[model samples]
Target: MLNKILLVCLLFSAGSSLTCKWMDRDFKQYSESALALLKTMKTNSTNSIDDIEVDDAVAFPNELYKHASKESREERLSFVAHVLDEIYALFEENQTRASWPENTVDDFLDIISQQANGVRRCAGKQTTNHHKKNHRKMSLYFKRLSRHVLEHMDYSADAWEFVREEVRIHLHKVHLLASS
Candidate 1:
């Protein structure tokens, strides 16, 4: 509990201390779209499952794949598995609390599984054929996950704000890379 508090404090301090404007415009655009979807989920509105926008999701995985030269094939696969595992855990933990239709929940899990399979299939390959499609899945998964968190998690206001800011930072970095 104390650690979470400290982490949130650190994130808040770090975010406030940074005056970087290089990625502001791109970050604003990216965060706004994602945040809009998240807000719909928060209100339990009827949003299309296809409303998941993952346009900025490809940058990190592409970066990882490109920089895998120093690492062995096994290492790269392990990294991908680790990421998938976290997503899986988050899905399992929050699936019940989301209160979406049963079909929607099941469909979301199917998408998650497909994403995992795609990562496994391309782990050590030169090309990521599922890059764009998997990114869309990732974005959808995040919306559902955030909805669960917003509705069920016991995070304080500051902590929730910190999470949003963390996402903003991540999207900003992804945008910077994608733009360049």
Candidate 2:
């Protein structure tokens, strides 16, 4: 009984964090039309350009949304912060892995919030100005994220190359998510 209760609590915690992630992403779009565009993104099987096309996107927002039904906002951020921790751990695995500066939950929150805000902004805007606002916001957020990533990037040549490749895969997915 104790083990079952612990498991339930763990699952509950996970659900909340994922919901927060969804909430953050959903809030980014401001306009109804923009949302329709976002909804059009295709679900993808691969996360790399070489494996797929840079322009090709399998937008799976539903899959992402379904995940939100389980968590509260704080739980969601904590969960994602944990995921970020793991990613960094992988990057810093090797003794020669170079400097992968530590990232806090706030860092993940900063990035997630920016991305979500962009999406929410797009969703809220009315379709009048040929999507310039949507594009501009996404571009700005993406650029900021790229900069943050660069700041924490590993300096070792081999490690650098690997993480760069890793980032490319993730960025592609982000592009798919920002389809609106």
TM-scores of the candidates are 0.32, 0.25
Q: What is the C-alpha local distance difference test score of each model? A: 0.42, 0.38
Stretches of candidate 1 above 4 Å error?
1-78, 124-180
RMSD of each: 19.6, 17.2
- Give model 2 RMSD, 1 decimal: 17.2
In terms of lDDT, the poorest run of 10 residues in model 1 is 19-28
Task: Write one digit per residue (lDDT tens) for candidate 2, span 1-180.
Answer: 999999999998786566545544553342232233222322232333243222213222233322322344333333233323333343334324432223422243345445444433333323334333433343343344333333334333333343345443443444443332
How many clashes in candidate 1? 0
lDDT of 2: 0.38
Deviation from native of the Cα of residue 63 in model 1, angstroms: 14
Q: Report the C-alpha displacement of residue 95, candidate 1, in angstroms.
A: 4.0
